[model samples]
Target: MTAKVENRDFTADLNNKSSKAFQDFEREFKQQMAELYQSITSYRGVEIHSLRNGSVIVNYTVLLEVPATATANSTVQGISAELVTIVNSYLNCCQSNPACGLCFNASFTEVTSAKADSVDEDLCDGQVPEGFEDYYSPALTALGVLCVTVCDKRAASPYRCVHGTCSVERSGPRCECSERAAFWYLDGSCASRLSKLGVAVGVPVAALAVAAAAFAAFLLRARRQNLEYR
Candidate 1:
C-alpha cells in the first residue's frame, strides 16, 4: 500500500539530568507512548532527536495509505495538537509520580503538510514495516517497543542490522549488534551501531572460503581413490 508522511514537531527539556531522565521516560512511558500513538488515525511511527542543550526534538511521522481525505492543513493541525496533548499528559503523569522524576517543557515546533507519500509503507513503522503489529508493545501487562527503530522509508534507509536492532537510546541513530535483539529502532532504536555493510561483506566472504576449502578436500580424496584403484 502507498503511504504518506506527516511530521509533527515538538521540543522539550528535561527536569532532571538529561541522560538518566531521557532513559527513564523511554522506559516508563513506553506503553503510554504506544497507546497514545494508536489514537492517531494513520499511525506510522515516531523519531526523536536530542540536542546539546538537553532539549529534545520529536518527529512523529505517519504513512497514510492514500492522500488524506481531509484537507492536508487541517489534518496536520489536528494531529499535531493531538500529539502535544498526549506528550504533555504523559509528562504530567511523570511529575505526579516520584519514581519517574521527569519533567519537560513540550511545545510544537512545526506542522508539515500531510502530503508526503511512500509506496514503501514500512517507512517509520519499524524495520519490518508491512504490518501494523510491528510498531507497538506486545505484552498487555508490560510496556516496550517491539522494534528499536521504525524507518520512514522517505527519510532514512531500512536497517540491516546483523546482531542488534536500531535504537534511539542515545544522541543519534545506530545499529545495536548484541545477541538476541530482534528488531532495531531509529529515533530511539540504539541497540548497536554496526553497519549492514560489514555483515553484507563479511558473511559471504567467509562462506566462499569454506566452500573452496571443502571442494579442494573432495578433489584430493578423489585423486587418491583413483590412484589406488588403478
Candidate 2:
C-alpha cells in the first residue's frame, strides 16, 4: 500500500540489549507490516537509544505506497498504529524473561528525502528469548500479523508471581506455585526456592532432634547411676 524506506541511527552509548532489540524491531516490523499491509515499499532501517529511566526508545521511518489493487487498510496512520502496537507487545513479551525493566515507544515518519547513512549489518542473527513465545504469538495475532488459532486465555488481574507457574486467562498472565514448586518463582526459574524452603523447614526439625537425643542420654545416665547405688 505505502512505499517503505527503512533507516536507523544509534548513539555510541547503546548497550548490547538495546542494540539487539533495535535490530529485532526492524526485522520483525518489516515482516509484520508485510503481512498486515501488502503494498509497502522502501523499507527504512531503525534508530535505537536509551532513556535515563532504563527505557529503550526505537524510532524508524517507512514509505508506504499502497497500490490501487490492494485490500488491506492503506492509510499511513493506520499502519503506524499497527506497527506501534506490535512493537509494544513484543517488548512486553520480552520483559517476561529475566525481568527486564524496559518501556518501548516507536514513532514513524513519512520518508521525504534520501539519506546518506546506511546500516547493513546482520539484524536477524539473534533468537527470541525463552518464555516469550507464549506472549508473542497471541499479541501479534491480536493485530493482523499472524494467523488466528486457539490461544491460552489471559487472567483477570493476575498476581505477579515469582518462582511459580503462571496461569493464562483473559485478563493477563499470572504466576502461581505448584504443589512441588519451589519458592521465588518470580525470578522466572526455581533458582533456590526449593533449597531455601528445605533449609527453612529442616533447621527447626534438626534442632528438635538434637534436643530429643540429649534428653534421652540424660535419662539413660540417671537410670544407670540409680541401679549402681542400689
Candidate 3:
C-alpha cells in the first residue's frame, strides 16, 4: 500500500485558508467594535464585570477557538494585536475624555469584580495553587482603576506544524505547545516550518527504505534456491 498520501501540498493551501480565516476574524472584530462603539456610547454607564485592583479584567471567554491551519500561517495573531491596539486606544480615549469617566469607571469596576469572583471560584474549585492568592491578590490590586483589560481568544504564532499541538499556557494569554514539539517560542506556539516538514518527510522515507531492503533480501534468497535446484 503506497502509504495513503494526502498530498502535503495541502499545507500551503491550509496556510492560505488560515490567513483568510484570520483576515475574516480581523474584519469581524472591527465590525463588532464599530457596532459596540455606536451602541455603547463612551459616556454611557457601561458596567465592568471583572475588575481587579486597577486593571480591568479582560475575559477571553468571548472568543474560544481560533481556526487552525496546517501551516499555521493565520491572521489570528495580527487580529489579536490589532485588538490590543484597539483596547489601548479605548483606554487612552477614556483617560483623555472626562466624559468617558462614568462608563470607564463602571466598566473598570465590573472587570475587577469579575476577576475577583473568578479567583474566588478557582479557589473553591481547588484550581488555585498554593501561594496563588498571595501572588494574584497584590497583582490584581495593583492593576487599580487605570489598568486595561485585553480580552481575546489568545495570541498565537502563524506556524502550526512547528508547534506539535496547541494548548493554553498559564503565562499570559497565548496558546502553548510542548518544548519537545515546539520549534521556537513566541506567544507559546512554535514558529518554524522547515524543520517540521523535514521530520515528517524523513520518517516516511526511512520506513520505505526498510521495506525495500527486506524485499530485496527475500528476492535474492529465492533466486539462489531456484538456481541450485536447476
- Please tell me which predicted candidate would have the highest TM-score against the true structure: 1
Clashes of each: 29, 38, 22
Q: Model 2 Cα displacement at 19 (Å)? A: 9.4
Residue 199 in candidate 3 has what lDDT?
66
Give the candidates in order of TM-score, highest first: 1, 2, 3
* True-structure lDDT of candidate 1: 0.45
Model 3 residue runs over 4 Å out of place are: 1-175, 178-195
After best superposition, candidate 1 residue 191: deviation in angstroms? 62
| lDDT of every predicted structure (CA atoms) | 0.45, 0.42, 0.34
Which 10-residue window in model 1 sums to the lowest lDDT? 1-10
> Which ranges in model 2 have alpha carbons more than 4 Å from their true place?
1-12, 15-53, 68-74, 91-230
**Best-to-worst ranking by lDDT:** 1, 2, 3
Instruction: Write model 1 residue lDDT over 1-230, tens digit each, in one string.
Output: 11111121123433333666555544443444556568676565543333223333433344433243224445555676666566555444353444543343444334454553323333334444344434322111123112333332222345444455555333444565553343333433443444566667879999999999999999999999999999
Give the Å shift of residue 117 in candidate 2.
Answer: 19
Worst 10 residues of 2 by lDDT: 116-125
Q: Give per-residue CA lDDT, model 3, range 56-155, as digits (tens).
A: 2222222313223321223333333343433334432344443332122322211111111112212222333443222121112222211111222221
Error of 3 at 122 (Å): 20
TM-score of each: 0.29, 0.23, 0.21
Candidate 2 global Cα RMSD: 21.2
